[model samples]
Structures are given as structure tokens and as C-alpha cells.
Target: MRRYLLCTVLFFTMISCVVNRTVVAKPILFDAEREQLTLEYMRDRYGLETSSSAIDPKMIVLHWTVIPTMEESYKAFYEAKLPNWRPDLENVSGLNVSSQFLIDQDGTIYQLLPETTMARHVIGLNHCAIGVENVGGGEGLPLTRKQLKSNVWLVKYLKEKYDIDYVIGHYEYTNFEGHELWLEKDSAYRTVKTDPGEHFMKKVRKATRKLEFKLVPEK
Candidate 1:
């Protein structure tokens, strides 16, 4: 009887650790303007006429902020309007690029927006994909081992909560171009991406192999 009780307690403890992973809530400027812009983006870009900016996430797209520090990364996504520097993206939409989550180099996870909301990180799959941006991916600031572990944890946590089918790198977004999940209206709007590199993605996938995420479609 005592052995059984100990086993039960251990199981509950494991569950608690999984559920209580630290995720700091550092929400960006998802104000009224951002919400409206998000709705417009969905309608104009993806051809989905939804009143709310909420999304039904089918996949998680991982990214890396080329910017070096956590503060800079946060500031980049703080504004509702796209910055002038990002003229290429600004031409496409006024809605600034943002992600649902951002992980610092030290592996601190910040929730920039709700997981089930649309973020402009991925070009074609934003409507149904959750974005996770990691700080510092430049030549000098490669992603750390801690970030990789945190990403794996985040992926598992999100997968458990949502019906997520695929965990893809930002670069892999284009592979789903012709799949039903692809929703961009303009064929010429695609951009080449190589954030949160293939090595990082392979680690995340191997760590969560038991989740059985679907492989990325052939490009």
C-alpha cells in the first residue's frame, strides 16, 4: 500500500512540473488598432473574414530574432504598426510582425500574445500557426542549449493544450505553400526565411518524437 501511494505521488509531481513551467506574460501592443489590423490581415491576406483576431492553431512555427538582446526583441514587437525599417513587410500590411511567444537566451519564455491568436511571424501560415520567436540568432549570438530545451518544453506544452499537428522551423513555412493550411492570397508575397535553423528544429523534433507531429510537406 505504501509503494502504491508513493508511485501516485510521483506521478502527480511530474504532472505539476509540466503544468507549472515558468512562462512570463509580457504582452505586446495588441491594442484596438492591432486587433483591427489583425482582422484586416486575415481578411485581405488570407481571404478569411473573421470578426475576431483569434486563430485555430494547427502548427507551431519556431523563429529567431536576428536582434541581439531580449529588450530589443520585445521592443520590435511592441508597436502595432510595422517599423519603417521593415519596408518590405510594411508594403504588404500595416500590422507589425509579432509572435505568440519569445524565449530569451537564458531560456526564459515570454508570452507576447495568446497562443490561440494570429501572429505575423510566418508568411503563409499565420492564420493557423502559432509563432515562437527566440532572441539572438545572429552570427555572434547563436541559440543556446538552454533555449533548445525550453523550446522542446514549450512545444510539448502547446501540443498538449492544442491540436498541433506540425512543429516547423520558420524556414519550412514555404513547404506548406500548396497544402490546405496555406492561406496567403498573393502568390508573389512569399519571402525566403532561415530562422531557428534546421539543427535547432531537428533537436526540438527529436525531443518530442513521442508526440508524433506530422512531417513537413514536400517543397
Candidate 2:
């Protein structure tokens, strides 16, 4: 009986270690210029003129890089200015696109920036959304099962750390357009997204349904 109890305790301990694994730090450029650009974006796009770039997160947004590798995705978000390749976003602000956390294909999580700092990921909800971007989701580079497990762990971790109320995919951001959480000033500036596809989100939502996160608002 003693041996059986010890074995059960060990098994649960191992499981806890895997679920609460440490996130690897792979920070992007977040100099004074980037901070200024972030503030400018908040003021211009969301009509939120604040002195600091800090945000009180209320939602978590999951995304797929569409870029093949972690290194390439990191480079894309390295600088403060929008790259020439992303002309569609340049009109909005010079601040380059980024997220607070980035997950590699192997389930390794990276913290690109501070958790509460605002990142320009989801439209209309940047003011209060924390973004988690997975390394691949384009062509042959589909997101791996390891990445899904990592995302679930990450969502639970963030929910525990913050007062998070909702978890939504990048593709579902538009559904909150007129909801109280929506704050974009330019209605015409919306862009259609199909990232971290429906199947992926359904699995994540199902796994995290016990958290009691609010449902996505109807469009």
C-alpha cells in the first residue's frame, strides 16, 4: 500500500512539471522607439491616448505565424517599423506587428515582450488582448500537436496570472466589433483573418471550457 501511494504521487508530480514548464525567453526589439510607436498606435487607432503602453488584459488572442520557422517569425517582429513586405499594415501605424508570447513548433514557448504591454495583434482589441502566436501555419508547415498542448498550457497560465475573461482566435476578432470590448475607431480599417483555423480553436476551447471563459459575442 505504501509503495502504491508513492508511485501515484510521483506520477502526478511528473504531470505537474510538464504542465507548468518554464517558457523560454526570446525577446524582440522593444526600445524607446518601439514604445513610442506603440503609444502612437493606441492613440491613433483606438483613440486611447495614454502616457504609458501598459494594458489591463481582458482577453487572450491565439494566432499562427504563417511563417515557416521560429527564426523567421522572430525576425518579422524584430524591428519597430513595419517591413516593406507588410504594406497593408503600414497605413495603420509604423509599429511592427508582434505578440507577447510566441510558441515554436516543438511546443517551446517564448516571451517576445512583457505580458501586460500592448502588442498590435488583434484588430480592435489590442487595448486589452494578450496575443500568443504559434510559429507555423502556412502551406506544409502546419501547427504541430505539441504546439496545441503548449497553447493550452499557456492559456491556463495566463488566465491564472491575469483577470482574463475571454479567449478567441485571430479569425474571430471581428465578432466583437460592436461589443463593449471593441474599441477601434476606424470601422473601415478592418482586415479579414483566417489564422489558427476553426478546428484548432475548437480543440483549444474544448480543452479550456472548464475555465468558464465568456463566449464570443455574436456578430
Candidate 3:
């Protein structure tokens, strides 16, 4: 009985270590009305069924918030209901853009929205891509190594949970514009993106190469 107890204790210690390695903050759920807007956007923009707000996500697009501080970034997202002064996006959803996840410079991860739910982070590919936004990438506030490591952890977690097909930086999303993945209604509504730089993408792809994501065909 003592030997069996020892084995059980060791087993639980390993499980505890595994969970500690990939620490994530509890999600702050959005109100029903905001989620409803996401559902309506998916249907109206992509002509998808409204049975659920969860998207049939196939890709993961990484981003960086140009906003300098974490506090300001959270406030911006928390306060805004509709996108301000963006006339083109108003027709798409009129909703201020958000991501499924956001990471702080110190490597803390937070779920801003449900994993499968669509948030308007990327154009043309929002219907099929999940966005992961990092809290810094501005001139004064660059991304950190901690953020990169945490991203790898989070991406691995997501891969195990979903059939994730492609992982790309926000800039690379345009490469899929002509592919079947592109589903935006207004052709001219596209915006250029450079968030989550090439170096960051290279690091993530290298760490996650075993996941076997599909290539974004050349334009």
C-alpha cells in the first residue's frame, strides 16, 4: 500500500508540473450582446450559418498591439463597442476589432473571447483564422522574449485542442487573399498589416514546425 501511494504521489507531481508550465489567466467573458454581434457578423459577412458563434477556424494569425501599455490596450478593447471612424469596417460588422487571445509583454496570456468564436482581428481571413494579439510592438515598446516563449506555449495548447492548419503572422494573411480561405465581401476593404514581425514568426514557426502547418502560397 505504501508503494502504491508513492507511485500516485509521483504521478500527480508530474501532472502539476505540466500544468504549471503553461499558465494562462482565466478568461473574462464578454457580455451576451457582444457575442451576439460576433455571430451576426459571421453570418452577414460570410453567409455562414448562425447556429453558433464559433468559427470553423483553420488558421492562427499572430498580431502585436501598437498600443504602448497593457492597461491602455485593455481599456481600448473593453470600452469600444463599434469601430470608430472606420467607414469600410462599419459595413462589415461595425464592431471594434478584437482577438481570441491577448498576451502581455511579461508572457501572461488572457482570452479576450472564446477560442472558436470569431473576433474581427484580421480582414478577409477573420472567418477562418484565429487571432492572437500580443500587447506591445510599438517603436518604444518592442515585444519581449517572454512573450515569444508564452506564444509557443499557447500555440501548442491550441493545436492540441483544434485542427489548426496554418500559423502565420498578420502580414502573411494577405497571401491568402485569392485562396479559398479568403471570404471577405468587399474586395477593397483590405488593410495592410505588419504586426508581429518576421522574426517573431520565424521563431514561432521554428518552435512549432512539428505541427505541420500548410504553406501560404506565393502571391
Candidate 4:
């Protein structure tokens, strides 16, 4: 009887370890100030009107900043408010641009926000998607292999934590079409956006497929 009890305890201990390892912990970059302000911006700028229980994420969207460095991109996204450069951006402030994660050209992953909070990266889908921004997409700083690998790791991590159904590129967000989650207040808000292009998203999807995530349909 003692030997049987010992075996049962060992089995449970192994199961606990597996659960712990698979669970995605909140990324370290989550700033309380930024999180609170982001939620407020979502309410005021996008008119999302979310309650504490409303922010259940269902997809992960990938993007590129077009900026040269990760630090610059981080600074741009870290501000509590929006910027004026994108004055044409109808959503209150350009500061509404944010993602939960940022992957650098060299392949370093920077967690800019937590997975549970809403980031203003994608219009219509911000309430149900987690955005991941990749640094550098211009001629001088192209996306690299390292960034691709890091994206795979990050996608897998998020899938393990949330009930994530789709892993999509920013450009493909429109493909959701009639899905209930594709909602935004302004019709003009659905402007054309192509970032972290098709090639990059294809790589991310192929890598993440090994982990069993469904790829967002190509538009």
C-alpha cells in the first residue's frame, strides 16, 4: 500500500511540472501604467466600453513597425498617450498603436504589453486579438531568420496560455470579414495596411503549425 501511494504521488508531481512548463506566464514587459492607460484609450478612442470580464483574447496578430531599431519602436509604443505624426489616424491618437510583443531584427523578443489587455494595433479586432510587432521592415533593416524563430516561440507560448484560434498577419485581419469579432465603430477605420508582409507571415505560420495553431486565411 505504501509503494502504491508513493507511485501516485510521483505521477501527480510529474503532471504538475508539465502543467507549469506549458503555461504561459505573463511577459515581463507588462507595465501597470501602460496597461491601465491602454484600457482607458480603448474605451475612449475606440469606444470599446470593455468591462473587467470583456477582454477575452482569441487571436494573435503580427505586425512590423518599419522603424530601424527595437528601442525606438518600444519608446513609440510605451507612451501613455498617442503621437501626432499619424494625425490622419482616426482613433484618437497614434499612441493607440501598440502590441503585446515586439520581435527585433536580431531575433530578440520584447514584451511590450500583457496578453490579457487590449492593444490598439488592429482596428475592429483589438478587443479579441493580441498584437505582436516586429522591428525593422525598411530597406536597411529587413526581417531576418532570427526574428522568424522568435515569432514561432512567442506564438507557441501565447497559444498555450489562451484559447487562441488564429495566428494572423496584420494584413490578413480583413479576411475575417463577417466574423463577429471583426467589429469597429468607423467604416473608414478599415484602411489598407500591409506590415510584416506575406513572406514573413508564411514563415511564422509554417513554424507555428508544428505546434498545431491554425493559420489565418490569406486574403
Q: What is the C-alpha lDDT of each candidate?
A: 0.92, 0.92, 0.80, 0.73
Provide the lDDT at 22 for model 4.
Answer: 30
Residues 1-219, candidate 2, lDDT per residue (tens digit)?
999999999999979977779899888999999999999999998888799999999999999999988999999988988999999888889999999999999999999999999998998999999999999895678889999999999999999999999999999999998899889999898888988989899999998999999999988
TM-score of 1: 0.92
Angstrom error of the Cα, residue 74, model 2: value is 0.4
Off by over 4 Å in 4: 1-48, 90-95, 215-219
TM-score of each: 0.92, 0.94, 0.84, 0.76
| Model 3 TM-score (2 dp) | 0.84
Which RMSD values do the candidates have, in order? 3.2, 1.9, 5.2, 7.5
- Tell how far residue 137 is off in model 3, in angstroms: 0.2
Tens digits of per-residue lDDT, candidate 3, 1-219, equal 999999999999976854787545544436777777777777766777676777788889999998877776666566336646456667657567788888889888887777877778887788887889899895678899989987888888889988889999998877887889887776777788888999899999999999998887798
Model 1, 1-219: lDDT tens per residue?
999999999999977866788999999988899999999999999999889999999999999999899999999999999998899887789999999999999999999999988889998899999999999995889999989988999999899899999999999888998899998889999888888898888899999999999999997
Sort order, TM-score high to low: 2, 1, 3, 4
Residue 89 local lDDT, model 4: 70
